[model samples]
Target: MTGWTEYTLALVAFTASHFVPRIGDLRGRLIGRVGRRAYFSVYGLLSLALLVWVIVAAGRAPFVEVWPQAPWMRWAPNLLMPLAAVLIVNGIGIAQPFTLGGRRQAVFDPADPGFAAISRHPLFLALALWSLAHLVPNGDLAHVILFGLFAALALAAIPIFDARAQAHFGPDTAPAFFRATGLFSLAPLANRSWRKRNGGRLVKRTAIGIILWAALLLGHTAVIGVSPLP
Candidate 1:
């Protein structure tokens, strides 16, 4: 496709992915209309399809390198991506009260000490970091625009979603919710909470994240067919 076509497609996909959830309490409405299981299935399928299209289109778009990356920015991904991975793993593995599992009282308690000190939304933070890191290295118009859009969405969606969540759940419930998942919201307080809860499990996840980061750094050329380090 032409550059304009590629840019348009990328923008459309990114905007749809970010803005769809904000449409008229669509998430709750979907759950109420189709039931949880069916809603999740449909949502997941549509998201996956959009993601696949974005990836394929990104690969086909002609890359016009905008500028030479600084040494620091090029290397920053090595550090940030690993941290991002750790956050993602911890968010998935930890039974925090802000998560669906923890919220339902399935695995952890709301008043648990660990859950009380950590941000509930580590996964979103992880994704945000990954997007930001890539935005630094990928200087092409399409790449910058696409990754930049994700970074903006990840940052913006946190507070908007948090407010909506608090409204739906309750004002009294906000503290625990914030404590459990505030990291995802881009609040300084949440970062402090996350640091306080940095335990052995978090360290182990960091180690795993390091390994994943190394793999990505070494394999970026092959997987993405571009030498990021160059």
Candidate 2:
């Protein structure tokens, strides 16, 4: 239970930072007053700061072994994080009205839904993947609690966000949007039609994802005090 108080407080603060902004029209009103870029920038910094506190506090907390360290476990994040990074890079600043990264651009044609056709909630999926991947290597109780909640929350947010999208677009329009995209479908990736339309953009984003993955992998030990290498 050592340092548990700080860990718990940091976790609560981090969680509240996200949900508080979205309560009723708080986020909308904040954006109205402070502009979208400023609002997100401040929110992002606050979230990042709280996240760092949570991680540091977890490190200071009592270590209770849930599973013994295995050389093989380290490979999970190494293998999965690149895909997660790809999802993250592609998901950011997209025009998919059905997901978190939507509201950035003004245009989103359900007909040519781009990446949304493959996964409507790529960012959420990426978060789930990243958290789960880390959980494989981090078998301590504190790390488990930290990453487990993150994995659960990210997975839960997908359907919640989708429902919010439906509410926003209304019954008449939501069905068509749902028909055009999928929550977790990979069919679009294999489809010739989607490939013809979004292949170039996908390739470009994948390259960026690879670069991001490399940067994180190289920076992990310096930033987090552990190498991600298996």
Candidate 3:
């Protein structure tokens, strides 16, 4: 299929994946109408199907250069990928209470340190970073569309998810969530705080980052049939 055809299909899948979650808000009514488990099962399956379709479409689409590739940008992804990976790992390891997906506790504790001090949604931020890093290097019609859509989704979802969380959890929870996890979303500004929390763990984050960088460098050519560094 043509890149345009693939792009269109990807857009549809992406839109469905994002918009489907919003319907969960109607749970009370929907669950009342349909069985609760049935509603969730259907929604989960639909979301999974859409996600798989988008990934498949993205993989099939050929890269069509939209702009001149810069030598510097080639190096940038190599640098950023590691940071993105660390954020991803931190998100996985940390028990951030502020994020919609983070673990919820009965009591709030300020001393609860983790990736929360860096960003409320480190995982989401990592995804955004990874998308941006790849988009910069790919700078092609298909990649531009795919990564651009992903970047926009990652960014837009944060606020939307935060709002939904506040609505569901109450106004009091929003402030703490914002305070704890907001920093991770913006790395440069959170450096001081991240250093304090991570301290000796910075070495661990760096090691994880290097592993991620190497994995991407090695895998990009095989997976995409193009060496991003070259």
Worst-scoring 10-residue span by lDDT in model 3: 104-113
Q: Write the per-residue lDDT of candidate 1 for residues 159-197, one digit (tens) a residue.
A: 765676577558776666555544534343345544555
Question: What value of lDDT does candidate 3 attain over all alpha carbons?
Answer: 0.69
lDDT of 2 at 130: 93
Give the TM-score (vs. native) of candidate 2: 0.91
TM-score of every candidate: 0.71, 0.91, 0.71
Query: Any runs in candidate 1 off by more than 4 Å, and if so which?
Result: 21-34, 62-66, 93-110, 113-116, 168-173, 176-208, 228-230
User: Given candidate 2, what's the lDDT at residue 73?
Assistant: 95
Q: How many clashes (backbone N, Cα, C below 3 Å) per candidate? A: 5, 0, 7
Q: Can you list the residue pairs that collide in candidate 1?
A: 119-180, 120-180, 120-181, 120-182, 121-181
Residue 42 CA error for candidate 2 (Å)?
0.9
Of 1 and 2, the candidate ahead on lDDT is 2
